[model samples]
Target: MIFIEVIKKRFGHFEGETVWQWTMINDHGMKISVLNYGAIITSIETKDKFGEYANISLGFSDMDDYLAYSPYFGATLGPVAGRITKGQFSLDGEEYQLTQNEGANHRHGGKLNFSKKLWNVSVEKELDQIVLTFEYTWADGENGYPGNINAHMTYTLNNKNEWIIDYTAHTDKPTIYNPSNHIYFNLSGKAGSTILPHQLWVNSEKFLPIDKEMLPIGEIRSVENTIFDLRAGREMMEIIKNQDELLQIAGKGLDHTFILKHENGKPDAVLFDPQSGRRLEMETEADSVLVYTSNSMAGDFEINGKTVPKYAGITLETQGLVDAINHPGFGNIVLRPEKPFKSKTAFRFAVES
Candidate 1:
């Protein structure tokens, strides 16, 4: 059975509205904490091979920390995740400009992105799993997007230790809609420790090359001879230390979106930490997965009273291709009134024994 609790009541208030947090414990003893603000996954506790439970998700213990300094920690990113060239996009022969928060480009929506908004939350038991649902409605022209979009995200923790995220959205007008969860995972369960020891395997043999600004340059290149080749499991540190130009351009680490070869049930990526013997298999239906190694953390934020330095965690963001709206060759990110949008991504946890 799954046990659910409201560990924090009125965790914070946004726009004079009360926001709350909920905790769900699965039968396997996996615990997940979520907040209404940003529909964030505050914490995820799982056992290692030694049977010791620890929080594997990088986040702050205090709500104030989340409000003051959150680098998209455990937050849901939407209307359109990733960057749009020059904060501009054309839809139906008309151009629209968005609020530029990330330099000259619009990133993860806009200046007032979904990650900073409050969501209406609900919890219910779906079979043996505890499902936490978060809903948010974006008005037309909010952040300069052209639609009144209604988004629903559900987090389900099952007995098998799988945390499944289901995302669905409907837009009244034609607009770009690519949503993703930006939860940083450190299988070592130590927030302060670097995730360099973790081994990662991505099923993709190709990744989008990005410019200095971190926006995809519209070129999908092969990962064969570069450090981007994670088709076979490789330690993150080994790949980081490689003298690859792309790695140098990306701040000496990974912050690129890999073109996922598989579309459905197949696992898109696998991450394992040898020290803790903790393993995570990511299965998603999204077209691409953004692998960010937290290279720009700056060691300024404190999580659980410990300083979180650079490379402390890795974020696997599965969503429609980055900057899809600007690249015609990229996957479709348009959501119209006649057709709703839907996507699912699952993170299954286990021990390597």
Candidate 2:
């Protein structure tokens, strides 16, 4: 019970090049589009509370905007997501130094990580759901990291209004790999207003404190009375602006991870926008969740620009804590040849009465 459609585009007559566009729509009308280059999500359309369909994720209109203007919107962030302290780590008594492309620390996978590469894409359409698959092969020392890894990512949308993203990677040599999507959620729409009115709740009792470079400080600080506590489902910006202690500790906004407190099969976070009557529940197996407010979104992106001001969109990223390779207690990022490293996260959208 599957359907398939392929749309090809011209990307010049280069020797070894393949350019194409594909869209997969489920029976429930949930649609997802992907391009061969960058393995980027071109558009994702979902119905709102009013039964109106719209694109909920932020993305560029075409491939050119994706290359020049966009800053990781709706792209697969791979190899590693956050910072690598001093661009260095020691594994099995061997010290490896990564390229410091962004200032002093290695950021979002050094210069040309998975996001910048063209991936081989395949589409699977079923009776009730659609799946988009992307595969990438990385050689040893491709981006200052040691690994000959093969990564596969599957994106699926079901009739029950759930968007699931699953990642699996294996390496011939032991190396760190953290892969996730950079999909900015503006529940109100891409050109809509800020997400300050949305209600958010995270099931976490402690958060890892970080320094100015955004590296964890080897301690799990309590969030009893701190602004980091989102256990009560409060407005995100209201809590951020009013909490003086959090402002003092982490500056203007949040860019940190909350160690999830889930011990069973349930959601760790929930977000609701009353104005639109749209709700989203998140479930993941990752150890920590990083919530980032788009504090630095300039008006550089065109076509209905200037939608999100400072702290407009909120990113709920599920992954291990930042700089896990260096912190012994935080866990290790060793992917061996026999073990297939895997992680899964899901977002369920609903309409409230």
Q: What overall lDDT goes with each candidate model? A: 0.89, 0.76
Tens-digit per-residue lDDT, 28-68, candidate 1: 77899888889888899999999999999998767778878
Give candidate 2 regions above 4 Å deviation.
1-19, 190-192, 243-251, 303-308
- For candidate 1, report its TM-score: 0.97
lDDT (0-100) at residue 122 of candidate 1?
81
Question: Candidate 1: what lDDT?
Answer: 0.89
RMSD of each: 1.5, 2.7
TM-score of each: 0.97, 0.91
Q: Please write out the lDDT profile of model 2 over residues 1-353, one tens digit for every residue.
A: 53333344554211267556666666667667666666767677777778887776677666667667657777777688888898998887889999887788897788787778888877776766777788999889977789899999888877777879899998998888877677677777647467778888999998888887777877888889777778887787686677564454555677788899986866899888787777888989888888877766775555456544665577888888778888877876777788989999998987785
Top of the candidates by TM-score: 1
